[model samples]
Target chain A: MCLLWACLLRVSRSTSCFSPVSCSSWAAAARRCNRWVLGVLAAAVAAGTAPGSSVRAAPGPRRITTDGRRKQDLAWSPDGRLLACSLYHTAGQIGVALFDPAGRLVRLLSTDPVEMAPAWSPDGKRLAFVHVTHSGTDGELDIHEMDLEGKTRRPVIEERKAFDMYPSWSPDGRQLLFTTTRDRTQEIYVSRADGTAPRRLTSDPSLKQHPCWSPDGKEIAFNSNRDGNFDIYTLDIEGQNLLRLTRERASDTWPAWSPDGRHIAFVSRRDGNPEVYVLNRDGAGARNLSRAPGFDDCPAWMPDGRTLTWVSDRDGGWDVYVLQP
Target chain B: MLCIGEQRQEWCGGVRRRALVQAGFLGALGLTAPQHAGLCSAVAGRAVILLWLWGGPSHLDLFDPKPDAPSEYRGPYPTLETNVSGMQVTELLPALARRAHQWALVRSLFHQQNDHGIAGTIQMTGRSPQNGRVHPHAGAIVNRLRGNPRLLSGFFVLGDRLQQGHRLIQGEGGGQLGVVYDPLRVTYDPVAGVQLGEVQPPRGVDSARAGRRRSLLDHLAERSPTPTPARDAEALGQMYEKAFSLMTSSEGRRVFELEREPPKVRDAYGRHRFGQSCLLARRLVESGVPFVQVNWSTHVEAEEDAGDGGWDNHYRNFEMLADRQAWPFDQACAALLDDLAQRGLLGTTLVVAVGEFGRTPKINPNAGRDHWPGCYSALLAGGGVRGGQVIGASDARGEAPAAQPHTPEDLCATVLHSAGISRTDVLALGLPVEGEPIHELF
Candidate 1:
């Protein structure tokens, strides 16, 4: 049985190789014999592991944001002095935090259920993000704005019984674009900077999420799964002239427009695993910027556009890293 | 009170009555004649198809939407109005939402065990596990009460075999009632064509040859004749007869052929395994099978099989459900309800769908949900259940049942009751039945 299992594993790492019809039987067999096989496999895996292994800094991709907790939705302050991110702490507590340009922890801006697509105000005085008031069953999600230097936080847009998230401020900071599920499906919406008078931007049954605004505020780029899988898409601020940027079968998501608007930095799982990729504005010259293992996702461009910061689990846990693009 | 007395009388007399019936069946098996009259009277003619969602699905994100909760607890989705006034479900279930008049939900169904197998045992057997003994599954109990009628097995489990690592999960087999009452297990991929590997005879073995072999065995039994050989021979003969009937029966063979359904009808159920399995389940019940369980993807481990859709969404709960799980479930369940109603089988067939438990109210940092057995929900449709009604309520944050919660046993009692088996009836049959049917569901 062990030899047969070993042969099966060696032949196919992906469950795709096995016939779906027989997988049910094999899965049943695996469950029945997994305990004994697990021990042997564990021993084999342990023997394969190098002794006294620890996470070491890889050659490229310098580590930037380091707090031993999860960090997501990263954005750079206009002057490049600070980084704003949705920070997750122990005991299910979550909030937004600021990191200095030198990779040091700044004060946590707000520690509530801060979720999705944190953005910096053009002048860099306030942060906009989706704050989750309650979670799981009977939960509410809304876009929130808070002063970076103060404790004052207010709902920019309150969605009473729906999910309103992924807020991205326009380059002029006068309009905020975000994604909401209030329409019963994910659609893009643009609201006033203060979160009043919101108008629906894009309407589709397919998911349209993680909207990002161009620096010039002329176009809005976001991820859509309308083509069966998620791909980068761009549209005018009025939601007209829709254009699909990336055409790969692999999912390309979380589009971050470069400051100069020449490239869009995004995450793609096209090469079997997620990696940071940068593509030119017209979808040509697509190059993988982060070639490291583990999931490299949510790429945020530094103000200079020559550098990019993203989250990676290559060190066994999520940490922010900056790469010279 | 009258019902209790009648049930008790039946139970007390049933032991001796069953023995006599067994002897008659054995005598009949010795001959080549089919027991036609006995078959009709033995069965209740009613059936149930349980779509068991193997892993614990998040109640918050499915049937029981808590839209007013905070964002972290609210999840990333929104709730939409269903056809039933004042009833709302997550947008992920748009298909089911349109058919709300066909189903009812018990939003307060819950139990203590959170682990998959342990909770599965609780849900399947409708009993809290005791150290020394195992409780019979509802199907097993049904099998014992309504014996197979040579037409079809009383209980059948379709789809992937459920197991935890290397062992079959608890409460899946016939427990205290013994293995003979266990459902006929058919492991097949619903997405691929149905092929009952072990249920069918080996290739090149025709029914005539099978009958000849049975005769040879019978001849040998007569020649040797050990003590109690009649009873053993009867049991073996019964087993052979069942297999032969399944292989030779036109209705049985046709029911397993999913291709026989129209393309539009097949597409309505969606092309996925769960959807296809549900359609197959309908065919099974339509063919007179008493109980059929179509388990939704038995690969229960969250990490390896999340894409396969067992609802243990401990990590990437939102992504996993959004990407693959909810759409198929919504499409399949709605299609099943529609097909059953259109075929006029809904009145006689009871359909139940549920996972073992619910996910935590608090969303973890991984943007996922963990196990929370404190409160959950289950859906019931068809049979005698009143549709478009919510039987119970969860707390403001969905932390626990707002009122007194319904235990797994209560749900089981309701299922049995819908199948025409009263709680007292099971008790009188010398089975350790627990919990009362939720009277509100009737």
Candidate 2:
């Protein structure tokens, strides 16, 4: 079992070079078990430290879309070429929209109303999103990753009764992080990119959704309210080391890591209303970024780490606002 | 015995309404103990818009903020000062806080049932389910007491029937009064505005043909699972009357055309489901609909999953409320109040906004509040009721009523009273429990 797990863990880390043997049913179990062992061993040997760099001061905020449609939960592609956002097509209608950095519509991947919260796969060839269906007694939320063409879709799990939503792909595109009620409550979960080999990372679920991966693939930073209030926390890929990054009585949710993994951008209500805040990996020097009036949330960092995009209702209704500072 | 406010009953201009609730009590109320005809009448032309929060909203989060309580109970949000002195709401509700003087807050509402199905039945019916004899929803009761002739149905639910999972909440319909009194439910979406899906006449079916098919209203309600067909000849006649009422009443049909309103008006209500629905409710009452219950969502737990859900935030309560629920409510509810008052409809239209119950006082491991029927809050406005007042009070921790703890029964009675239904008339209806109106508002 150890040998299988070790081999599977090695194969899992290499996304493009995954062998068929590592993707077998046993591989999922092995990877779930052996990844922790390998990660802990690797952490002890490596000087586990991230550079503490912050965002530099920059320009004013700009609106991305003015079509008057409500957009939600943005994901900046790994290549920094485009962004995928959940767009409101009409009332009771929501779909994934892909837009270039210039706010031009590259293409609408899917116009299906049930789909929401689009996240781009590291390869940029595919997009993972929440596909909501009301077939079950209660509405069901499932994660589905599809190509940009909107063809060829598959569920994250072969069969799921519990609600799954807001999927985040690993940098290597081998694993996906999402929130699921598989355990009868919403919790952070990690499954293989193919939706096999499911694993539970955190039992404490406070709905501080959207767990993002570090650029180095060593740690995963997410917002959790397990400590009485919503705050950001970082845990190693192995789930062995967990560190609280932001300490605020107010909710500091939706954490997004910069490309360099130097700074983390998260939304906070510490200043009365929600504002975009960026803090170093050590949780120091937290400063308000988007000081706009209405309420700002869902902060997504640009790959360059110089600027980020967030949604704000400052001008009456919610629109994508980009702020450099 | 008739009064407007909870206190100062007789002195509160408690004009005794006479002979309005006459001989129909036995047939309408369907109670075992028959009432005498000496009952006072309910004020006519009075309308009610019940903004059903559906799932239980958190008392600690919305109107009844426990700022002085421990972090475990207080959670994240701090209270913001409202226009009315000493009234504070969650910071997210700045819009509602600014207009606090427009509505009265009842902070000490409590009940025994924490389960969604039971508690929802309690609030909707204004009484607990007893001996399998479910009480009629407050809206149905209001309509039964005083029907609205201008509208197709006396009571209108501006959304789908309220439900939790597969099980329907017991008393959303006419209940003991019979299904004939069920609120005419309509659905509202951004693209569709307000679609009278259930009540819409079939395409190409002229008025004469529609009349021939007296079962038209029976086979209607495609959006609803249970379509109410004509049960008997009398019901069939009533259904036929309803069909012709909407088919011919162009004035009544115009109320559903939400686009007729100015762009500024629609924009002010915010471009969301709850916002648009509230606007429709205002239009409904404006057009003489006696009761309008605007359901927040069809089911209980809906965060981003459904893009909409009710106040039953068992998990992710704060996040859901902040992102999905609270701000829209603040914008739409405030807009609704402002619109009613601006149109001169506020004086006669009674608007009640409340969920079934309140959430738990202490925060749970899921970072959400559980169901708590022990203490909750609601907002009451218009209908000749005085504003800028806080009724009752919650304890320091907001775990229970600190003073003047009232049940859902009182809320129902208060709604009826505000809509011109007198207390003695309610007593004459043979209701299992007659909830007294909170006389403080008058």
Candidate 3:
């Protein structure tokens, strides 16, 4: 299997630059080769058939998990020692599952059955995530923060009949930036770290989601359908200077600002399906980073802006993978 | 001789003849009439693919965005224009938006039952049984008239046993039409592939072994198989025969080998259980199965797992749609329509995608939509139906029908009518169909 993968890799590299091949055909060969090789190595390691040495020597991209379950909302810890992601700990169950930088399970953080979009606090002592529960007459969704022992008390953002999600903490950890449907339509809001004294930021009636504070803490970036379909948008802390960064007819969402603030990594449907893409902070020099022909989403930058962790279903099921671009 | 008897199980040639004779006797007594008495033409090639989105999907957020409604009512999500004129759907359905010309939507479908059980029954069987008698599933009624191939039972339900409130959903079984008319429920395990249930022989038991066993079973059946007090003996006998055939007949079983589909085709369907099941539903209908109902999930689970949970979105409605549900549905349903069209089966196959009811027009405290049976939407395509059309209209707030309100009976009647079964034919089968076909579709 290794030899076959190696030969195919060589062939794919050789054919990629050939002028006569159409762009799609070129992509097809390379993706097939990548998927086959990565799927094989990951499967072998998962099955315990390959020793650590083979996996260490043969891989191109590191697969976080070969279980082939859907995983997303990747967040690298502030100290850069751990990764937090929403992964299925059991069949049909999704929650915050932590992993070491090398993809070893650190611990299963929450068992809420549906907690996701985890954002680690700067001190790495807590994980703020959206927990959804249908225990109420209707259902209730609120962002909650879990301490090191996986204990959650008061919600960070909970209103009587409102939804608050995608809790991105201000860089200083004194404030929480999130999107809520309280008081009015879906819009961004900033509240005290303990879910108090909330102030509405955006007045757009259009739906907005996945709000994250830029590392500099001076601006906020989110995806909204404000200009029609969903596109990447950024604004200052005061919700002024709203700038649309993407104009593709297809939806662009789930923006993760590069740690260095030079670029934004987001999921784009411009290619007709979800693929991880990177564009400059000003939305220039855009390119598809995960060009494989299937759903690739939730791109998050590592402490080093060069690496990203995302989820892809290209190998037939949702699995986490890491690649540096 | 048309046989109508107390026995409801659909049997093979000999037993079917017996039932026809009994039915003829009943017809003579004016108790029931033969379905052939109807003036409707039964199209042998016509089939129906019912994509049962088990739990109620939000009408406000999906087909009817109600963009101008109040914040509490409209929630989030904007609408986008479709290929069809004067029709729009939520941006979550971009794929479906592009292919809107290939399908039509009925915006005002409603029933009084907000509970999943009764509503599901009403939708699947056309009307709930007020007389305390379970009505046959529409598929059973369709099969009673159109008659599916013996190789693959005409009606196939792809998913596990669906239940609510700890009991199986009301109309999933064959109901009073007898266990035989009950759909052949097939479970597709994402990891284990197609779990064919009784159709597949046990491990270490290959086809040849199963074939010998089948011969024995056939001989036993010919000699009058032992009584099954739990179910009709003839029905069990018929099921045994079909399972043997599936195991023995390469062509019959190969239809299930979804891997036979191109990787690209499978990916095009979005690579999940629901998506693949849609692909399988298409394959079944294309192979001449008369009725196929693809249950979105085995059950309506409000809490989340990955994406396989039902559409009951009482909470986390937007998250469920944006994260797990909507796009995959759009991609798969669109792909199904596209594939059927490409295969030229679209004209013969009637594709209906709907849920038991719609979600609340108001967004709930949990950012989810609760069950609302007052108004909903259903999508239809193919089977001689005109596409790129909106059959009805919803109120501005999406709380009720503003124009051309239709009932679950109308939805069922539409499926049957598209499969060439008429309202009179349903009556002839001793089944009551309350709503007439929405003729505007054609």
Candidate 4:
């Protein structure tokens, strides 16, 4: 499979300058080659006949999710023992679920139909997520913090008539930042730990989403489409010191800061399909952490800052994967 | 064979058979009845101009906006106040908002059959396709009741021909009523010019000249010892005569010459094919055609995704509606209403703008609205319709009808009723029309 890919890469480089052929035809050839390689690798891995497997104990990123469901908005628990994510089953059930580091189903936190954007509190005792209930076309979205040990879930930010989503707990756990369309457009907002007294931030006329606080607790990173397509941008807690991180034409979203505050991991379509990419804090030296086929989205940095957990559909369906970059 | 039934003569099963035979005989002699030419002169009576929005449009985003509904349901845009009190439309329709007094809205329109093909047939025919039997198109039934009137056809369909898959969409053509009542299908292009390929005679064959040629051919055929030439001649000769009349008549030619309209008036209708088609519909109605259907676009979903194809909006509904679908519709519809009113044509022309169904209110994960036949909206203007009033209401989320729920057949009945075609006449013709004329609209 590697040899075929290498040959195709060489062939692509040689044929790229041929003006008579359109780029779409070249893309088709590359796609055919990739599909063949993926099919062969999948067969070998399934039959246990391959000496060198892609998911073996090699020195590279490892896939943790294999449930064949759509997993999104992945976040590591404060202690990093488990990962919480929103899973959409093929049968049309959407809920939040927890998984151990080894990718085992720990427990479904909530199967409340329309839940997404699960965030763990800094103390690791509670989970904060958005639970939405729709009535035909009209729906209510509210943030709920669930007690891990009991059924003591309570509303955090119950904006009854708004799409308040993508909640994140501050490093100190006293405040939460979330994206809401309460003002007619998607913008970021800050709320108290109890989800009260919400205050608006980042009031751009365009859509802003997937906000993550920097490890230092002073800056918040989020993706916005204020500049045509979505790109990552960071702003301070006071809504000042705005900085643009990624400016590629392709969509770059779901920004997550490393534990050491040195790098920001994001999902970008720059490489053709969505892939996990890491860039320096100062917006330089960007490199892809997951170069596999299929869509890779919502990368969350582990506490150790060496591993990044994300959801990928490369194995035919979405699963959580941990990459050591 | 043409005897009366046990109950009533008009309700007899052989009425359709007799009608067909009568049509055939008259068609053979080239004495087809001219229809509704005096329809415009009759006070309070009017012709119908149908702006068929092929796919279902989202009611929440356009007519029955739920500003107070939940964020996901209300969508991103704010509602704007129209010229009429207690009425509001989406900010996307500013032009129509200003002209709210000239039109009335039926907000509680609903029907079954969510599939595009089935719903389109039901809405267009005003009767569901039952047991695999296609009903006559509403226009066909109207043309049947009010025969061809001047030298022109009564029903005209302008723009790209409507289709589902490779076949003409159900109800787009004549069904059990026979092809004689089928709409005069016409295609128009700004650069390539108007094409009436099906209705235009061979070059240099004016109406008088074509009639002379037909007589000569008939004389030759009678001399020849050919069997069953009379029936074949009747059908072929009928087509040629209709084509000749349409291609050569001064009135027919004048209605198609869109360059007669001022440049400013043409620009007001937008430069797109759908807008220009609406402009052409006005001309046909003015020329005394009883039913003129202006299709929004030709290719529905075959060329683009759902939303771009006349409001299917299966993917990125907000972006597609905000960018591609809403503005052109608002401009063309508003401009049409203005033009019709200024020319005093509104009093005699009933304009109905609607789609097969409405989009789902609960947006899917793709940010697109799927087909929802449960509830939708239709706009009615002119033909003595009470303007600035909403006929019925949908629920807070614009999901289903809350008051005076009406089906697609009922909407069709309303359109036919506005055109002064009685429900009794429709029933006598063996059509499956349902609902009343929406008394509130009248």
**Which of candidates 1 and 3 is the stronger one according to lDDT?**
3
Give lDDT tens digits, candidate 1, residues A198-282: 9998876666768988889999999876665578999998889899998885567889999999999988767645689999998
What are the candidates' C-alpha RMSDs?
Answer: 18.4, 18.0, 9.6, 18.8
Tens digit of per-residue lDDT, candidate 3, span B1-442: 2212243545443334223222222111110011122212323389899999988888887898886777667755666788877788877788899898889999989889978888999999988877788788888887667764343357878987777735677787677667667676666655556656533333344456545544554554465433333445555555454444333334445456676676668767866678889998987776667788998887676445233478988656776787888877998999999999998889988999999999988766445678999999999999988889988898989989999999999888888889888778877867666888899998
Candidate that scores best on TM-score = 3
Put down candidate 1 lDDT per residue, B190-249, tens digits, no spaces.
Answer: 222554533434334455665664565445445542322344345545755654544444
Stretches off by above 4 angstroms in model 3 are A1-68, A79-81, A99-112, A131-164, A174-208, A223-252, A262-296, A307-309, A312-316, A319-325, B1-44, B67-76, B198-236, B241-251, B305-308
Give the top-scoring candidate (lDDT).
3
The DockQ assigned to candidate 4 is 0.02
Writing each residue's lDDT as its tens digit, candidate 2 over A103-195 gives 667787775556888888888888889886765434456888788878888877534666677688898889988877666556777888988
List the lowest-lDDT window of 10 residues for candidate 2 chain A.
A47-56
Compared with the true structure, what per-residue lDDT tens digits does model 4 show for residues A1-325? 2333344234322211212233344445657778766555544334331112244444446666545455778889888898888866422245788888877778877755566679989998888998766554233667888877427888888765566777899999999999776775567899889888888887766657789899889999998766655688999998988899888856677799999999999987676556889999999999998887446777898878888888765543356777778
Model 3, range A256-294, lDDT digits (tens) per residue? 998898899998877766889999999898898888866
CAPRI level of candidate 2: incorrect
User: lDDT for every model?
Assistant: 0.70, 0.71, 0.73, 0.69
Q: What is the TM-score of each candidate against the true structure?
A: 0.56, 0.72, 0.76, 0.54
How well does candidate 4 match the true structure, expressed as C-alpha RMSD?
A: 18.8
